[model samples]
Target: DAMVIQNPRYQVTQFGKPVTLSCSQTLNHNVMYWYQQKSSQAPKLLFHYYDKDFNNEADTPDNFQSRRPNTSFCFLDIRSPGLGDAAMYLCATSRGGTGLTSSYEQYFGPGTRLTVT
Candidate 1:
């Protein structure tokens, strides 16, 4: 059951408005990361939480925020999604347990395609 899932695969929001995206998993993994990917570009890390140790990517904008209320779920909130926020939001998960050699191999969800008009 190591799978990541995202809801509302597509979202349409007005410019300078707020939006929230959700993710959940049955993997029981302790590390969860959120990534933003623009058209044809590599997924860029927005932030990650390693068993409550939150790590934010330096380039992530203030408009982007995340929350991990529990081990199985996480959320991405955009305070004011601009036109530039139009892209794909990918949620990924990985194990944080010892002896897991491939803990870094992230498993991504189908992703939410956001369109900011």
Candidate 2:
């Protein structure tokens, strides 16, 4: 099985503040994804990485991502977090796909819970 790791289990931030979340994988999969999940809602794909290429959801704004193969890491940057941004940030990795949407066995990290004041 692939291993995905996320740092800092919990986070607290003030409204309009910027925050960064990170994820790293040992599998070195070609695709990586970031998701935002609410208390009882399904996870929503924020963006994904295919190697150095990034695919961001069209509706997601004020979000950015970067890849560092040297560390097998992907970082999610929320430029200005709002109350709505208070959610669990999930990091997942997959072996191969035309796009992340078509991938399988997306090994997921435990996630980082973000709280907005």
Candidate 3:
């Protein structure tokens, strides 16, 4: 099955500690994205990588960062996690081009639930 995989489905970290969440995919999609979701709120797009180009949302906090070392793998690093940062971190991959006329479909991972205490 070609899909996204996230490690440590649940993570617990103390306030101000650094934590890293990972995502990998077998789909070989050209676009990979990271999103932060809290409860009923809509998932917020943190950043995405289209091949070697990195795009970050303007409103994304500096505390949230991502790295795509390769096509199959990506990492989200929280420099200093706060209690408010506890939420589900999702990694997604999309095929085709992202454009108004393109038919791009995004597939998401189960997500990593982070707990900051």
Candidate 4:
């Protein structure tokens, strides 16, 4: 199945608390990403690992980090979840085919909605 799935669809976190979200895929893809999307706004690219190459969005906050030790699993770690971190965290993956035109399309997970006080 070519799906990126996240667990616990909804997560409640306290202010300044830490949380971890998990993602997994069966696509055998080489690229995976984490995005943060707030209410009624465009999703912000957080970070991603393209195989062994790590790429981070310049605007992503320092509190957000990600790890992908292997091909099938990835994790997003929020060291200190603040109110501003309350948003929908989306996981995505892309198969390495070619240039942007061939491999740029990303498949998204159901997403985990984080709530912070």
lDDT of 2: 0.84
Models sorted by TM-score, best on top? 3, 1, 4, 2
Q: What TM-score, over all chains together, does every model reach? A: 0.93, 0.86, 0.94, 0.92
- Worst window of 10 by summed lDDT in candidate 2: 62-71
Per-residue lDDT tens digits of candidate 2, residues 1-117?
Answer: 658999878999888887888898899788889998999999999888887788979877755555555538988888888888899999999876666556577889999999999
RMSD of each: 1.5, 3.1, 1.8, 1.7
Q: Lowest lDDT 10-mer window, candidate 1? A: 96-105
| Model 1 stretches astray by more than 4 angstroms | 98-102
Per-residue CA lDDT of candidate 4, range 1-117, in tens?
567889879999899889999999998889999999999998889999999788998888889999998999999999999888889999999886676545777889999999998
**Residue-by-residue lDDT tens digits, candidate 3, 80-117:** 99989999999999875756755478999999999999
lDDT of each: 0.91, 0.84, 0.93, 0.90
Q: What is the lDDT of residue 18 in candidate 4?
A: 91
Clashes of each: 0, 0, 0, 0
Give the residue spans of candidate 2 off by over 4 A. Answer: 64-71, 97-103
Candidate 3 residue runs with Cα over 4 Å from true position: 98-102
Give the alpha carbon lDDT tens digit for every residue of 3-84 in model 1: 8999889999999888999999998888999999998899999999998888999999999999999999999999998888
Candidate 4 C-alpha error for residue 87, in Å: 0.4
Report clash pairs, candidate 3: none
